[model samples]
Target chain A: MTYCVGLRMKRGLVFMSDTRTNAGVDNISTFRKMHTWCVPGERLVTLMTAGNLATTQAVISVLEERSKAQGERNPSILEQPSMFQVARLVGETLREVISERSTQGQAADSAFGATIIVGGQIDPGPPRLFLIYPEGNFIEASEDTPFFQIGETKYGRPMLLRGFSEDLTFPDAIKLLLVSFDSTLKANLSVGMPFDLQTYVADSFEIGHEDRITRDNPYYNEISEGWGRALREALGQLPPYDMG
Target chain B: MTYCVGLRMKRGLVFMSDTRTNAGVDNISTFRKMHTWCVPGERLVTLMTAGNLATTQAVISVLEERSKAQGERNPSILEQPSMFQVARLVGETLREVISERSTQGQAADSAFGATIIVGGQIDPGPPRLFLIYPEGNFIEASEDTPFFQIGETKYGRPMLLRGFSEDLTFPDAIKLLLVSFDSTLKANLSVGMPFDLQTYVADSFEIGHEDRITRDNPYYNEISEGWGRALREALGQLPPYDMG
Candidate 1:
């Protein structure tokens, strides 16, 4: 299971992904599911992926391999003309990855899904967010759905949906995400600790934050503590049940 | 679809369940999901159920029918000495309901899952919580897994896992549950408005606190507001991403 969220806020874009993966509960492992492509001030694109590991990595490898071609014109992340183009390229790349994996040799290997969040800014425009569906197509973020959550999203989504309002600062977005993630982590054994977090301020022409939070990360710990304490405090504040 | 949770805490037991039941997206109806048959001060018992309405109603019908019998000696709930026995009786009732439905001969449908939460204190012991499964079996709540959630539980399960501590006041428990349900309601279209909530103090020996929370419930509004405010505050406090 995976829990990755991309928030496209008035301030900028925030991306976070859990580092746990389990193939049946017994075979659990940590694998980074985020991919970053940076051309400094030119374009900063990041993708947080969820679903089949092999499929996701293969998609990333396709993009990476494209950037390394020696002779002909290669359409690479660095070469994409715009953020929209970058998303299109990603969809095309993922489509190819799944197609290549389809084979008669693989018996009973049927339905597949790989959802990805593409968010970033080119030096020219505001940071943007897109939800690339399993079908190799995507949708951009809008006022109605300002955020996209992939993998184990149901548990923590309400916080993002109802809590997210316009004019929300980058920081508020991050905090909402932590509680959402905190909620998800506690409920799901599949989504474990040590999260990969990245936040980019819109039009800053660079990523403002990037960190991997383990159980010991101070800020992460603080938010978790404050949330629990606040919850208790909130509970105390509620009018007592008139069961007496 | 419904959301029901049973928690066993030092202060006693808390049970809450949403009443909305829908067979599909279009046909939504409200049927009470909670039922209580208490001997009052001498014995207090509450039964909260979720899944397959027919099956659940059937189980309740059987139990109620037996309780009303003038002289029956077959391990009825009224005759049970311990809350554990009552749990078994509920589990057995569920098994019987499913079995009767299956024996009607339609290729043995696997469409039967009616789990019940039975919590109460008999004449003399600590109040306990039990989750009755479909197979005429049950599991009691313990310290490590202090709560049992049945039916549409995954979404809200995370919030409780993170926020639940034995020290949390019953109000806090209720607050946490409302937020959890809020998350579930937003993410899943099947679960909806107007929630049924009930909270019990350990040895009070009666259904003391109960409320029907509709769209206009004041406390419900406060919880949703406070939750959003806290998330935004938490986000503001996170260190800005420094992705170079």
Candidate 2:
């Protein structure tokens, strides 16, 4: 299992993902699930994936290979004209990978499935965020739903639903995602640290900031401990149930 | 879908369950998923169920009818020697119902399965909680896991993990449960209002209190609103992320 989130705020987009992957309880391993592609000032795209590691890695490998090619031998995410087209290219590539695996005798729906969150900006348009399904279809984030979470989503969703706003500042947005991720990490063992986090400031057409938050990161520790204490304090403050 | 929780505390046991049942989004209905059986001064047992409504209802109905029968025509929960035995009875009954449905050509695992949380106290024994599965097996909640939640569980679990304690007061336990339930309700359309809440005080050998909290309940409204405000305020108080 995995937990990845992409938030599309008015100022920019925020992407965060956990690094733990497991084929089973005994075969746990660390793998980076966040991938980035950039043409510098022309375009910047970030992809976060969850599900079968082999399938997601294959899809990423295909995209990476295409991006490094010199000419039009194959269309690459770098060559996409808009964020929407970039999402389409990623979705199609993911479908092709899963299809190949299926033809090799693996079940498409269960064994080779993966979900992707694509967010970035191309020179011609505003930044966008999309959640691409295993079947190669996708949905864009809207004002009503400014965030998309894939993988072990439910444990952390309440915090997002309660705290998210379209106009949140970058700092506040990251804090919100941290709280959400903290909740998931505490409740589920499959979603472990360190987390990969990246932010794209609006209209920059470049990555704003990126960091890998490990268990020893002081700031991450502070957020985790502080949020836990604050939640307990808040529960303490709620009016006691009336037994009458 | 449903969300029901049972908490075992030093002072007593707390049980809360949402009443919504659905066969899909369009076929939603309200049905009590919490049932209680009491021998007044002898014992008090509460069962909260989740999963297929037909299987759960059949299990509960059979228990209810047997309890009302005279002259020991059949063994009933009233005749159980201990809360553990009561759980075993419930588990066996659930398994029997599913097996009967399976013999009628339904797939027992998928279509006729039900999960139950049973908590109560009988004379000469301490209060206990057990989670009964469809296969007639059960596990008791221990100090490590003081609460059990069935159905739509993930969204609300973090709160319980953070707030629960073996020594919580009855009122505090109920408050924690309401917070958990509120989170589930906000994130899921399938689990909705009017909740059944019951508390059993230690050594009382009978229910301490019970209430049906509906949408118009004022205290419920206060807790819901206050929790939302508290969470947002806590988020605001967290130190802002440094971009360095």
Candidate 3:
């Protein structure tokens, strides 16, 4: 289990994911959920996945394999003209891996379910984000829905409900996400850190602003303590319920 | 789909549920998810359910029927001596109904996956909360884990994380729940409006302050707006991500 969020805002695209995975309670391990594919000045794509690690790894392996194939028309994400096409290629790969594994009787359902949040710019259009399903279908982000989440998404919905907006600054987005993630982490053990976060400033097809946010990350610690205090203060501020 | 939460706090107990039932996106209707059995100052038990509507309705109907039966040796919720016994009765009722319906083979295993949050006091004992699973087994809430959520639980976890505390006032608990429910409503269309909320003070067993909270409720409106503003303010307070 994991928690990952992709935001497509006016300034750029933001992708964040936790680095925790578990086969069961005893086999818990920290595995980064975010992966990047960049072509320097031409394109920069970030993919974050949730579900069975083997299945997601297989999907990514296939994409990397097809991309390096000698003049093959396998429709690698690097060669896709648009984010939509990239999503299609990712979905197709997910479907392919799932079908192959299911043939060997793995019961490829939610235990083996895989979904990806794909976000980046393709040189021609503005930054975009997509949530590609296990079935090889997907939905793109819109002004009405500026963010997409996968894995342990519900634990963080309340904060996103009121925090996400098209006009949000990249910093505000990251902070809102931190508070959201803190809330999720307290309630659910599946989504832990260190977090993998990357911000793409629309036309800046560079990949330097990536950070491996650990528990000791200074700003993160501030937000966690501040948000907890603020919440208790807020609760104290509300008018008491009078049942008389 | 449904959303229900039960809290066990020093102040007392709070139980709330949304009344929306849906088979799919198209088939949706309003049906109360709360059931109450009271004996003035003797025993007061409240049960809130989530999962297959048919299965829940069946369990409730059986409980209601058993409550009205006279001189029957078969144990039922109303006849139970302790709140723990009441939870056991609800679980047994749920398991019975599920076994009966499952024999018909109309639905899958998730159909029997109905969950109930049972809480209240029986005469001398303090107020307590228990979460009963479909198998008729249940777990009691403690100081370390003072709440239980069912149905569409994920979207509300963060809000509860931020807002919930053993020290919170009952009114604050209600407010926290509204924000949590609001988050859930915004994220999942399956859980919807006209919620049912009931709060019971420790010794004030006879007076169950249950209300049919609709979209027009003033306090509800305040919670939704206040939460939105509070989130924005909190996010605005975070330091901007220094992409230096």
Q: Pick the candidate with the highest DockQ.
A: 2
Give the alpha carbon lDDT tens digit for every residue of A1-244 in model 1. Answer: 9999988778788899999988889999999998888777778899999988888988887787745656653438878878898889888877777766765357445445688899998868678889997778999999888888999987787667756776776666677788789878866889988898888877777667888888987777777777766654544454543333
Predict model 1's lDDT versus the native. Answer: 0.79
- How does candidate 2 score on lDDT? 0.91
RMSD of each: 3.7, 2.1, 3.0
B193 Cα displacement, candidate 2 (Å): 1.0
Measured against the true two-chain complex, the DockQ scores of the candidates, in the order shown, are 0.37, 0.86, 0.55
TM per prediction: 0.85, 0.96, 0.91
lDDT of 1 at B39: 72
**Mind giving the per-residue lDDT tens digits that candidate 2 earns over B108-168?**
4467888999999999899999999999899999999888999999999988888889989
Which of candidates 1 and 2 is the stronger one according to lDDT? 2
Which whole-number lDDT from 0 to 100 does residue B90 have in model 3? 88
- Residue-level lDDT of model 1, residues B1-244, one tens digit each, is 8888888888878888888888778899988888887778877888888888989988888887755655653425767888988888898889988888877767644587788888888888788889888888999989988888888887776567667887777776777788788778767777777887777788787876788889898778877777656554545544542223
Which is better, 2 or 3, measured by lDDT?
A: 2
CA lDDT, every model vs. true structure: 0.79, 0.91, 0.83
